[model samples]
Target: MRDLTKGGKDRTIFIGKSLMTFLKGHFERYQEIKKQLGHEFNPNDLIFFNSRGDYLKLRELHRAYKNAIKRAGLKNARFHDLRHSHASILLKKNVHPKVVSEQLGHAKSSITLEIYSHVAPSLQEDAAHAFDEE
Candidate 1:
């Protein structure tokens, strides 16, 4: 809803089909719960909300994230790590950096490449193999 952190512009972050399906089911359940409470669901309302139907405060969200991480037996990981992981996975899968940058709402593709430069060696190897095949 708000402008991106770095770019200060609104952009769409496309989701994969599985995520889309999951979101659709979640929305349906939300609507049903609202109906049970004798309230109409607002499509524009935040997808995730606290029990009182408000956006979660940053600290509350962070606390929940930390608990989940601990329960999963992960250490030294923050919610932001998921974003970096997503970008790294895409780069390693040979997705174009420009596309990943757009998805990440980076000011430029170079920023994505700069941050995930460690993925470059694998990409270079893939390129070499592709060239050999050709």
Candidate 2:
């Protein structure tokens, strides 16, 4: 619901079924926690919050990400890399550039292409083969 984009523009993006299921389970857990807290629970609290039910600060989020990366044996990775990874995976799978751009909330498909041109060579080969078949 919130715009976390660099341009601060609000946009809608589709989530996969697996992610939707994960979110449903997360919401159920949150509701249970809220019920346990009763009067202490703030209905308007963010889904991601600190132990005290306050919105997580940027540093706190970064610290948690760092800890997770360390635990997962990842090196030289930042939180923003997750976005790059997602887009890269989608592009490599041959999803349309327009769709990828829209999902990434980029103002233009060119931006997506410019950022991810490295993934385009294989897609170009695929396109040439498709044309050959036709």
Full-model lDDT for every candidate: 0.86, 0.87
Report how far off residue 106 is in candidate 1 (Å).
Answer: 1.7
Whose lDDT is greatest here?
Answer: 2
Q: Estimate each model's TM-score.
A: 0.85, 0.84
lDDT of 1 by residue, 1-134 (tens): 55456647668778899999999999898887777755534434779876666678898899899999999998869799999999999999999999999998887899899999999999999999999998
Clashing pairs in 1: none
**Residue 17 C-alpha lDDT in model 2:** 98
Question: In model 2, which residue pairs have backbone atoms overlapping below 3 Å?
Answer: none
Candidate 2, residues 24-83, lDDT tens digits: the string is: 998899888998998577556677888778878899999999999999998969799998
Q: Mark the 10 consecutive residues where model 2 has the least summed lDDT.
A: 39-48
